[model samples]
Target: MLGATGLLGSKIYDRLHRNGHEVLPASRATGVDAYSGQGVAAALTGADVVVDALDMKTMSRRRATDFFTTCAKNITATAAEVGVGRLVCVSIYGADDPDAGRAYGYYAAKAAQERIYASAQVPATVVLSTQWFELIEDVVRRASLGPVTLLPAMRMAPLSADAAAAAVADVAMNPHSGPTVVVRGAEEADTLDLARVILQERGSIAGRRPRVLRQLPYLGRAIAGGALLPQEADTVVPGGIRDWVRAAH
Candidate 1:
């Protein structure tokens, strides 16, 4: 498991363990930096499969693109070299849809990451998911400016990170799940509204609270349009913002 210390990664590690698979987690904290090509080879020396739950949490285009592409290259190349049979990557929905946030750098970066795995010699499974309901706080933290919060005027089926993790673990444990799988939330929602709920429930984030919230559709047409919503979901996670917030606190 790559990025084993991350929020979603930790959940995935748990699920994989519950599924009775011996999991060895790899991340920067575990001395396995996929981007730097350090300790990755040794980590997968005898591993049969690798699940990359690695996440680059940033709104910056260049940073996100660089991080994903570099890390994907290193992981795929090294996995192929070490004779790993399968690679399971965790990504977002609409990563391959050009109209779905192509102008958004992070979307483009994720698309590039998917392509890297697709072209690899090792067989790979790409698990695409809608944004996790748990991520609203992180999004709020990044988008907040002083006493106000500005977010994308986007639509999301707010999936729970826990459910998404289960989907990844399922694909990791099975060989016939296919090359791609889409996991979505139970309900379609607005990002602006999700942010509002986050602030109202949490009161403040990172020691600061935003009294005002706004949403803009400037990031990309896909963000505002229905391009990012899942059309066919192999895994429809059961939860919404309200449920997430209730368990969040």
Candidate 2:
């Protein structure tokens, strides 16, 4: 498991480790930096399947593209050299679809990342997942001004990190899924409403200075048009925002 210490990565690591799998959790903390290509091949020396839950904390087009593209090259080259069979990578829903809003900065970088991974030697099982309920807090923190919260007016079916991690870990261990797959939540919701549910549940908005929520077309029209939602055949993990907060908090 690469990037095995981050928000989603840690959940994947714990799930696999707790289930009696010999998961080689790799990250900067363990001296395995995928971005730098240091100690990456060594970690995959005897591994059969590699799960890439790597992430870059940037929304800039140039920086994100550079980071993901470099990481993909380094990871794929190393994995192919070490004879790793499959790479189970985490990705966002509609990353490969032009209509799903790749015009956005980060989404465009993700599409670039997907292109490199798709052309690599090792067969990759791209787990295209929807936004996670866990991301609500991060969005709120970044989009908030003094007393106003600016949100993207996107329609999403957000699942829990645990649910998405479970699916990723399953693919890593089983390696029986298709080249690409979709994972999502039980129902669709407006980003504004999702934020409200989380904020209210956490008591973040109750005692705060008078606050307001506003929606902006941060990702253009595709997001609000439901282009990023789950496909009809996709199997959604059960639970919604409230379910996640109750279980996690």
Candidate 3:
């Protein structure tokens, strides 16, 4: 697995490993940088398939675009050189829409990566997934200022890392007929509500629920509304929100 070390990537590696697949965890820490060709050739030399789960911190728009485009170029070139058969990439939901109002840079990078992989000689699958349940706590942890936690007013079907890994693994092991697939959680959730749950569970707030405020971009309400819950189809998973929170805990 190319990413093999991030929260999702680590889960993918563990799932694939438990399923008895010979796995390779490629990353800068492992001496294989996907952004550079340094050790990629050797890492991918005998691998049958590759899965990409690399991530950048915070999903900054400009940085994410550059990171993904560059990473895709590097991975594709090296995978081709090493004769890898298939590539599976984990992407964010709504990445294909040029106008999806996702504020994170990672979304644009994912879209660019999709285009690059689509044009590659090797077969590829891009599995676009909804938000991960872990993100609820993450956003709260990061966005919480004083006693309040600000959140984007958006819809999300937050999947577990394991479920997402299973989806990606299925794509990696199977034929790539659908170059793109959407994988969603079992239940839809509000970002603020999810944050509230986390905050309550973690004992971050007491008494009344901390204010649930909508976060707006300086651009305008259009960017905030459109970039965030742009409509999309449901990507089904078996477990529900409670299950995801339990697993995460």
* Top candidate by lDDT: 1
lDDT per residue (tens digit) for residues 58-111 in model 3: 547788788888888888888888898888888887666565534444566778
Q: Worst ten-residue run, lDDT, model 3?
A: 215-224
Where is model 1 poorest over a 10-residue stretch in terms of lDDT?
199-208
| Model 3 TM-score, all chains together | 0.85
lDDT of 3 at 112: 85
Angstrom error of the Cα, residue 195, model 1: value is: 2.2
Ranking by lDDT: 1, 2, 3
Overall lDDT per candidate, in order of appearance: 0.84, 0.82, 0.72
Model 1 over residues 41-140: C-alpha lDDT tens digits? 9998778889988888676778988999999999999998999989999998886777663668788889889999889899999999898877777777
Candidate scoring better on TM-score of 1 and 3? 1
Tens digit per residue, CA lDDT, model 2, 1-249: 888888999999999998888988888878898889999989988888888888988878899888888988899999999999888888998765675436577877788888877888998888889998878777777778889888887888889888889888888887577787788898889888888887777778434432788788777788777877876535589878888887876
Candidate 3 Cα errors over 4 Å, as ranges: 101-103, 205-235, 247-249
